[model samples]
Target: MTAENVALVIGASGGIGAAVARRLLDDNRYSTVFCVSRAATPPSALAATPGLRWLPCSGSPEDIAAVRGELGDDVGRLARVVICSGILHAGDKGPEKSLEQLDPAWMQAVFHANSITPMLWLQALAKGLGRKQHCVIAALSARVGSIGDNRLGGWYSYRASKAALNMLLQTAAVELARRAPASKLIAFHPGTTDTALSRPFQGNVAAGKLFSPDFVAGRLLAVMDAATADGTLSYLDWDGQAITW
Candidate 1:
């Protein structure tokens, strides 16, 4: 860990988010770890750790300033920023199985969670990144979002929102490359992680397919660390292979 390295993990209350934060802490690669979540209180370990900064607010763009306020001058040291928050279900609604199941409100909420929320975080942290550092900003996207892989033709809202996320990530990468040049913006697929978000759908997952949060976190971070050195944005799986858009 270098004195100047700092890592930011948003949605730090969720399973994957918390696990990634813990992994970063154990890796000792960053002097400060900024954890943001909508939770009223931080996870227990984060609350107890030194050099861990917890910011509580709605995971929205406007609330980013509150986190910025807490981060003070530390934002410039950012080397990695990971967005781990996204929704697959709410109330009785889950991913749509057909066009008839689509609800406008649910679709909107999914879009905001999967795409807009992460973009807002990027907007908040994009400036002041030191030009000399190799910075990577990754958003957890889904392979099911891949248009090339879709064959069954279900989960309309989720598929569309994630596809939208890929577009945004790709476009942002182009601009960041032109400006920051050293920074990499990537859309990362965590697979069917064994989290509350995927719990209901896990019954049908093939053996060895459902992954623990820590496992996914480790793989994703490894990919981010190994690939950002190239300074080109990519949509990659946990194994670091490029995903079709």
Candidate 2:
């Protein structure tokens, strides 16, 4: 990618999102960085970055529209789009109870946060990708999302929603191959990080297994930089090891 390329990162208030923003800024590959989040302000570090612009709003239609307005018509083209927005509502031991105890409201909320939000982003920004060159769109996915890898299944809503996100991304990849011809849509597993979302369950993880946000962000950037337009839907660990399915 050129130095003038622009990258949009959703959920910029979170650990992963903030780290990714800093990494991108440090690389100097992108001329402009849009940090979108529901919070009114970005982290101090991100705010201090020269090229970073905070778009403080939720991932709602109105908020995205405001972002679009700020970007205007002459954005040239977007080189990368990263969706880091997600939620981990199901508790530590996985989904608290069996189907009998599951609530529809909770399930729907999980799906909305994990799956539907990404789809909305794609719908809103697909047309903004630069013409006649490969662009990357990556969404953070989990290995637990892989149906074929589900040997120790639990966390029904979280797992299922992430699986649905994977499916949506796969389908979008195929369609973009035919339509855009120069865009790659990918779903990545960022591994377990030492963030609030993963803290509750870190008890089960071996010592030193939890990654820092900086480490995960760097690896994710490396993967995105190396990805090509060819259909490559990978679910991998932090070390780049492919997860089943």
Candidate 3:
């Protein structure tokens, strides 16, 4: 929250990601807000925002490194990093309702986007996060990822991918404790937000539960503000409540 600190949001072209980027820039706590996305064009809402630097990245190792190179000294000043890259459905592919609907190709694609992509960004940012400055790294996870709390069993690939993401963050937190003691990692579940990601599935979400992107963004930043760098991965929801893993 320091005036001189910087914040970075990957997958900045998406609904929640764009919201977070806009919120950060509006807060004016950070001197610069760097938004990275695979999209060829920046989100129109953020295109004109001052103190916002949009970086085009493919979420590959090389692209991430190139972004770091582009940032130069700003990487060290990063106080918050949010990875919002994830996939639930695309084109003909949708969440599996049953075992019979599962397809290996679709599953693999979901896993790559939801699990591997975020980890790659985490790996690339690890060194930069090691600086003495306090930093919080948060990735968009889901309540469905919680094995202990799961009562409904469906969405096979999406659920598994988020679960894998949680595990990866947990393991990374342990290593980061030794290397970047000042940083904290978070796995966040944003609930049923009113976004394109949930549009096709919102028919079942109870009234008053479908949050707007702005509300989720505010809640997430508040959670980060109150969080401590305890060298653990906190799985939290939009309300700042802990999620069982």
Q: TM-scores across all candidates?
A: 0.95, 0.92, 0.97
* Weakest 10 consecutive residues of candidate 1 by summed lDDT: 224-233
The CA lDDT at 115 in model 1 is 82
* TM match of model 1 to true structure: 0.95
lDDT of each: 0.84, 0.80, 0.90
Cα lDDT of model 3 by residue, 1-245, tens digit: 56999999999999999999999999878989999998876789888788988899987788888988898777788899999888899998899889999899999999999999999888887776644768889999999999998789999999999999999999999999899888899999999998889999999989899999989998998899888989899999998999989
Residue lDDT tens for model 2, 109-218: 88998999888888777666555757788899999898998888668889999999998888887777776777877788888898878877788988787899999999
What value does the lDDT take at residue 39 in candidate 2?
Answer: 86
lDDT score for residue 92 of model 2: 30
| Residue 215 CA displacement from its true place in model 3, Å | 0.4
Which candidate do you rate higher for TM-score, 1 or 2? 1
Pairs of residues clashing in candidate 3: none
Best by lDDT: 3
